[model samples]
Structures are given as structure tokens and as C-alpha cells.
Target: MVATAESVAAAPGWFTEAIAELPEHREVESAGGAIHLRCWGRTGTPGVVLVHGGSAHSGWWDHIAPLLATTHRVVALDLSGHGDSVVRSEYPIEGWADEVMAAAAAGGIAGRPYIVGHSMGGRVAAVVGARHRESVAGLIIIDSPFQEPSGESIVRQLRRTPKAHPTRNDICARFRTVPEQSVLLPYVARHVAEESVRDTGEGWVWKFDPDMLRKRLEQGRIPPLGSLRGVAAPVLYIRCERGLVTPERAREIAALFERPATVVELSAAGHHPMMDQPLPLVATLRTALAQWESR
Candidate 1:
């Protein structure tokens, strides 16, 4: 479904207000394709670029971004094939880094900015830091696995899943199963589900090209943990006590970093620390930023 101003206006109360409050920009060209970027805080200010995980849009950072903006410029984008961003026929994890770089350039974000990412986004941030070492000031990875995936293994996983176009209802139903996801349902049903439409008479369909995820799974291999060792910037890894990234694994990943990355485990949170527990996440972020600046 193609997103337009009128459609966005028709979005639900929460979504409309959220989008309205954010500084939205468009037509930022990246190697993969053009993307729609939504930012907050003053341009040229010290900033943090937030990247969300797979199947999630930049809006997932809604709560955290505003709080971060109060102290530092905070930017988030609807990565290609997700949210309001243009869906491309093909893309990869490295390509996402390029898109981020383009958006940063367009926003006139000179010098390096703190790069914060979650899940798949964490992988992208690592790749970007490795490739454009000077452009990233520091890294904050939330619940990301440091290990790379074998290409063969990824391809096999894709082959097992059937490909099909998803409907708005289909997407909503899937999100309904997760407890954390429940909080986002109202907004999704209004903005995302409503915005994602092709008008087939029967009903509206999802705008995202299903092939993007399939292609990513097949071609995307996480960079080796050693690749991150070369990043000179300090690293902060935050994991939920009950999330996928166990304390043991977090420690193991931290040990791989030559610069001695700090690891923080939020006991009250899950995979989505900010959403599950915003206050603690914000406090942790503030402390981390202060510590990074002091050093």
C-alpha cells in the first residue's frame, strides 16, 4: 500500500499524534532505494540513530526516541520494505547501513553519531561501523546475537517457509500472539494496517513485498564477531534478563570486543527493553551516554 498524507491523516489518534510530533522527511536516496525518514530533536546536535529489528518499523522506538531527543538529536527511519518506506525488489543487511548513511547525510548529521540498534538492526549497525568506521561514534546493541549466520543455513531456512502475500488482518493476527506486541495493536490496526493496502475489493493487502524478508534470509549473513573488534568506538550491549541474549552469551560477546564493551542486563524487561520497561531503559541510556562522553 502506498502511504500518503491523506492516509496518514486518517490514521488512529495515537499514530497520528506520534507521526505529527516527529519531524518527517522524505525521498532520501540510498543504495538500496529511497526511504522515508522521521526524526526528532535539532539537526547538527549530537545524536543517536535508532534502527529497529526485523518485522518492526522505526515507530517501535517512539517512546525512547523522544526521551533521547531531549538530550541528543534522535533519528529513526522506516527501513526499506517496512513502515512508510518504499519497498524495493531486492536488498540486504549491508544495504541497510548504506540507507542509514544516506539518511544521516541528508539530515546534515556531520561527524559520527551514536548508533543504537535492536535485533537485525544491531547486525546492520555492526556492519556500518565496520565499513564506515569513522562515521559511528559508538554502538549500542539491544538484544542482538553477535554470531553470524551461515549463508547455506539461511538459504535452507528460507526454502522451508512458503511464500505468500500477507493481508493486514494476517499481520495483525500474527502480532496478537506476543504479549509485548499487544501494546502496539491499536496503533497498528489504525496506522499500519490501514496504511498497508492495495484495495483488491475483497479487502486491503499489506504493502510490504513479502520477497524482501525471503531474500534477506537467503542472502544476509551476520558479520563475524571479530569484525566488531576493529571498531574503535566504545560498545554498550543491553540485554533483557529473560530475553534471547542470555547473560552468559552477553559476556561472551563482550569479551570479543577489544575495546571492552559494557554489558547491562535489565531484569524487569524482555526482548524490548524500552517498551517493556521505559524508565529503566532511559536511565540506563542516560548513564551510558554520560559515561561515553566522559571517556
Candidate 2:
């Protein structure tokens, strides 16, 4: 459904108020592009880096970042080929991890930062927690899939294409979730749908490159995320009640954590908890971060 004037106006009061508190925008230079970071909160406090899922951008964190900013230097960056960032010749999990670190450093966020990522972003955070353990104090993976999909599903994902339209409204009209769910709150869905589009000169198009799904096609390999034993930091595995990750899978993934990995679920939330249940997600994150601050 398209986010019309009325729908945008219908955004939850708390959500509108949160986004009104603006953050500083900074440009981070990564390997092949200029990554965009929206930073909020005090400079000397502990740092938090937020990564969005495939085809998503920092805008996904708009209403949620401000809450965390109160106690930490929180920043969310638009990965390459998404949002305002330029597309690279190629994208890799390492490249995305590099962008997150680069953005954090450029924003003057000190300390081994806490990394929070959703979906594909979750995988990126996992990589950081494992490979760059010294750079992060902990990681929170939100509904990231741990199991590989069937070969047919992977092929279908790569071959899919976006439907182009003559106007922004036309595209937004058809906006829907990747793995469609019917229970998403209207205001939340409206906001996300509106943010996912861009006004190109010819017309409007999705903010992400459809080819991002072609990771297996281009690289001929999925990121080798073997055992979760390499991660040196605390882990909080949160799954949305209606998200893509199944409860059984959540247990399996959490089981791999060498250190105790706490798993929690948000009620009334789907794949995108930040959109459907922002407040609950914030509270959970706050509790975890508070411990880090006190330590």
C-alpha cells in the first residue's frame, strides 16, 4: 500500500517525535564508495553501530536511534548500493563490515563499540564480532537467518527484479515486504514503504540494487560463517514473534555461541522489529547497553 499524505500524517506520535530529534550526518569513505552515517548523542560515551538488512538503509533506524542516543554515541550507516551510498563494482560481507567500522571511526565514536544489526546486517555484525573481535565489545543479531536456503530459493532470490514506475506514488503503491507478512502495523509499514523509494530523473525506483540478492551468483559463495566460537563478545539474539527466523533455528544459532548468548523475542513484531515494535526493542537494547556502561 502506498503511503499517502494521510498515512504519513498518521505515523504514531512517539515515532514522529523521535525522528524530530535530528542527528548529525557524516560522510564515511569506504573501499568503493562514500557511506552515509547519521550520528546522535554524546561523543565521549560508549558507541553503537546499527546496520540495516539487504536493500535497506540507515533510514530504517531513524525512529529507533534517538532513544539509544540518550546514553550512547549511536550511528547507523547506509551500506553501499543502498540509500544515498554509491554502488560499488562488488559488495562483500567484509566490505560492508569495513563501512560500519569506517563510519564509527569517522563519527568519533570511541571504545569497542556495540554492534547491532538486523537480517543481512546481522550477518555483517556477526563477522565483525568474530573477525574484528578487538573492535567490538558485543553484538546483537536481530532476526538474522543462520541456516542456508535451498538452491532453488537462492536462485529465485537472485533472479527477481523490481517493478519500475513513472512516479514515486506508483512504486510505493506496490511496496511490500520481501517475505510478505500481513500483520505489520499500518503506520510502521507506511513509513518504511515511503523511505524505500527514491525519485530518479526518469522516475522513482527502490533505494537498493536488486542485484544485492546475487551474492551467491557473483561470488559463487556464501559467507563462510562456520562455528560461532570466534566471537569474543556478548551476544543477544532477538527474534521477532512473526519474523523470518523460526524458533527452532533461533535455538540452533544461539547454541553455537561459545559465550552465553541470550535470546529474546518481541511480541507483535515481524521481520522488522524497529518498525513494528520500536519501544520494546529499545528497552531491551537499553538494558544490555546499561550493563556495558556500568562495566
Give the Å error, residue 35, model 1: 1.7
Task: List model 1 lDDT by residue over 1-295, tens digit each.
Answer: 2234554356555444544575655558776467877688888878788887765676667656777777787778777887778777666677788877776766645568888888778877777777778778888888887665567866765565433335655543443212243232343334433443444556554445556646554326533433666777788989877667888899887776668779988776767665456567777888888888788
Candidate 2 structure quality by residue, lDDT tens digits, 35-110: 9888999986788999998788888888899989887899999989898887776777777888888888987687
Which residue ranges in model 2 land beyond 4 Å of their true spot? 1-4, 215-221
Output the number of the TM-score-best candidate: 2
Q: What is the C-alpha lDDT of each candidate?
A: 0.67, 0.82
TM-scores for all candidates: the values are 0.76, 0.92
Q: Quantify how close model 2 is to the true structure by its C-alpha RMSD in Å.
A: 2.0
- TM-score, prediction 2: 0.92
